[model samples]
Target: MTVTVDEKRCIACGMCAYAAPEVFRIVGSASTVVAQPEGKSPRVRDAANGCPVNAIRVEG
Candidate 1:
């Protein structure tokens, strides 16, 4: 699976970064997508769901 964050929709609350720092990060006060971990969809989904602005998206 692949994870993406819509920079426009992101609030930079650090939810994704908190939930899955390995796949996401708060850079320059904004949420940025990092390397997607292998076989880590569930964790990514948790991060996405935790996003208050729903800025995170997961794709297969």
Candidate 2:
């Protein structure tokens, strides 16, 4: 799976990081992908869904 964050859309709310610490984190003014797991992770999906501004995207 591949995970990405849209810098323009990110608001540094930290919800993505809070939802999936292993895959996302708050860096400076945005959320970034810290690790890309080999497969689909529930936490990753949750993080994406939890993003208030819909900055997180997940693809397989």
Candidate 3:
């Protein structure tokens, strides 16, 4: 449920926050990981996949 967004690649698109509000948020110019995604939830993967810049990464 670990979610991380690369600062260098994030574009603040807000899709991560929109798709996985529990785990992600847009802060200023970057997408920030707010909390870990729930176990086996599709939201996190969806958010990661939705990132046009491929900035979001999920582990475990």
Candidate 4:
């Protein structure tokens, strides 16, 4: 799966990192993709859904 974070919309809430630490991390004032999993990950989806600003995007 491919995971991406919209830094412009990110608020550094850390929800993505909390939901999928393996795929995301808080960097500076936004969330960044730390790892791209090989396939669709439930945690990634959760992270996307949990993002208050909807900055996380997951695609397969």
lDDT tens string, model 4, 1-60? 788888999999987888878888899999999889767788789889888988887877
Q: Flag regions of model 4 displaced more than 4 Å.
A: none
**Clashing pairs for predicted structure model 4, backbone only:** none
What is the Cα root-mean-square deviation between model 1 and the actual structure? 1.1
Root-mean-square deviation of every model: 1.1, 0.8, 0.9, 0.8
Ten-residue segment with the worst summed lDDT in candidate 3?
Answer: 34-43
TM per prediction: 0.88, 0.92, 0.91, 0.93
lDDT of 3 by residue, 1-60 (tens): 687899999999898899988888888899888777668778889988889999988888
Cα miss at 26, model 1 (Å)? 0.3
Q: Could you tell me how far off, in angstroms, the CA of residue 29 lies in candidate 2 after the best superposition?
A: 0.3
Alpha-carbon lDDT of model 4: 0.86
In model 1, the Cα lDDT at residue 18 comes to: 83
Error of 1 at 43 (Å): 1.7
The lDDT of model 2 is 0.88
Clashes of each: 0, 0, 1, 0
Q: Which of 1 and 4 is ahead in lDDT?
A: 4
